[model samples]
Target: MTSFSANLGFLWADRSLPAAIRAARANGFDAVECHWPYETPVLDVKAALEETGFKMLGLNTRRGDVSKGENGLAALPEREDEARAAIDEAIDYANRTDTAAIHVMAGKASGPKAQATFLKNLDYAVTRTSRTILIEPLNRHDAPGYFLKNTTQARDIITKLAAPNLKLMFDCYHVARNEGDVLFRLQDLLPIVGHIQIASVPDRRAPDHGELHYPTVFSKIADLGWKKPIGAEYKPVSATEEGLDWMNSHLC
Candidate 1:
């Protein structure tokens, strides 16, 4: 059977992080991940995970100044110091929370300088911790000007780095939007994939409502021997619990 991880970033946006973790556990999710938990006390988040007995799969580095249109710092040539600071902060938080991975956000950047900056930051990140370090390719539609835009670019970075801990964060929704062949990409990149996420294409809502058929996708995932819990990173149309029939239907 395939396992699912609730992404608290979208699923329970109104609740506290600790409460969201507990909610995910109560809702039958196998694990939980978050976007940013820096504001929450690490010990509080840790206690919730301990109490619920659910693994915290991953979390992302702080997107610098959302108001300023800064999505990430690592790829910006001028913000190298802030980028490393964000990486260090994520590592510390992950260590304290017993999280399994960190998705390093590349923000809005382009050109060789941006790629060089990203590679430098990634090297710094991988050497600091043994935990998996992931880089995701956000779709141009959702994240216009985002540095990493496709799996090929992400895969090439992983291969060039050659760091066992550095891996791709294969977000199916983004992949479908950017490149239509989701299953083929998943198969080709499985070896370097650290985590997988899903949502409805274009709408970014619950996976069950999407253009992609998750049952087929999930079956393909199982066939490919991906044993980890897939991340459900979609925004709910109503109460998160109400939209979870998709999970039940898939599991059955």
Candidate 2:
């Protein structure tokens, strides 16, 4: 039915994980996702999830050395050990928090070396955990030099790896910006897709202001038989709650 998941990463940066879960539940979100939850104790986040009955959709592995502009370690080649360690840490965190998936960032790597590293790390990741492991394609405009930059690349990697646990994190906003064939691409990629996220293209704001019509897209998702939560991964133009009228009417 295209249930909505609040992306606490963008939706409620001002609050703690527990508080954000409460806010998401109050706002009628069926589930919740986050970027990083390592700062907060897992018990508190788990307690909030239990209290709200909201699913913890997924979380990301830590972006290596944010100070040095390293986005992730998975594709760095030189950081293979660190990347595997990060994967193990993420699996532990997901298990502790009851998160269903883990989006392993590919960092700022490019070319064959990067691809090789990513493939090796992904192979290691799927072997270590039963939970879904996701690869998202960030738009070049928003994330220059990022290792993975398109759905096709992610799809190819997933295909080459042949890991049942590895899947795509299809962010509609990034796809639209990079490829622009949203509906058709969704049709092509839905089979291997594990999670879907949305935001206004160009502006990265709430979906209501986007070039894409989310209501239509949501309907299409339902028609395609997608049974997972559609992630609300957008920066609100104003207060996050103020921009949710569209979600309230459509998902809630």
Candidate 3:
């Protein structure tokens, strides 16, 4: 049976990180992941995971200077120092929390310079630790200027880097939006995929609410031999707990 990871970044976002972790456990999620949890104390997060026995699956490097519309630092050519700092911070946090992966955000950038910067930052990240390092392709609709725009780009970078620890974060919603044929893409990229996340395409809400029927998607994933807990990275339309009929129906 396939398991699920509650993406605390969106689900139970109104609660504290630790509280969200506990809530995920109470709600039957098998694991958890987050976007950025730098503001929360590491011990508190660790305690919650220990208390709940739910593995903290992954987290992302800080998006530098959000006020300036900076989504991430890794791919910004002139901000190499800040990008490396974010990587270091993420590594420290991941180690402290026993997290399995880190999504190194590429920020809003393009062209050769940005690609070089991202490659450099990714090299730095992989060398620092053996943990899986992920690069996700954000759809243009949600992140217009994001450096990583599609799986092909991400795959090319990963292939060039040739780091065993480096891998792709294949988010089904983004794939549907940016490339279409989500199942074909998932099959083609499964070897390089480190983690998988899902949400309703176009709407970014719970999987059951949109065009992509997750039961079919999940079935394809299982047939492909993917055993890790797929991340539920969607914005809840109502209180998170109230909208869990999707999980129950799908899991059954």
Clashes per model (N, Cα, C within 3 A)? 0, 0, 0
Ranking of models by lDDT = 3, 1, 2
* Tens digits of per-residue lDDT for model 1, 4-48: 999999998899999999999999999999999999999999999
Worst ten in a row by lDDT for model 1 = 243-252
lDDT value for candidate 1? 0.94
TM-score of 2: 0.97
Report residue 217 deviation for candidate 3 (angstroms): 0.6
**Tens-place lDDT digits, model 3, residues 1-252:** 889999999999999999999999999899999999999999999999999998888999999899989899999999999999999999999999999999999999999999999999999999999999999999999998999999999999999999999999999999999999999999999999999999998899988867787889999999999999999999999899999888887542
Score candidate 3 by lDDT: 0.95
- Clash pairs, model 3 backbone: none
Q: Which ten residues in a row have the lowest lDDT in candidate 3?
A: 243-252
Model 1 steric clash pairs? none
What lDDT score is found at residue 172 in candidate 1?
96
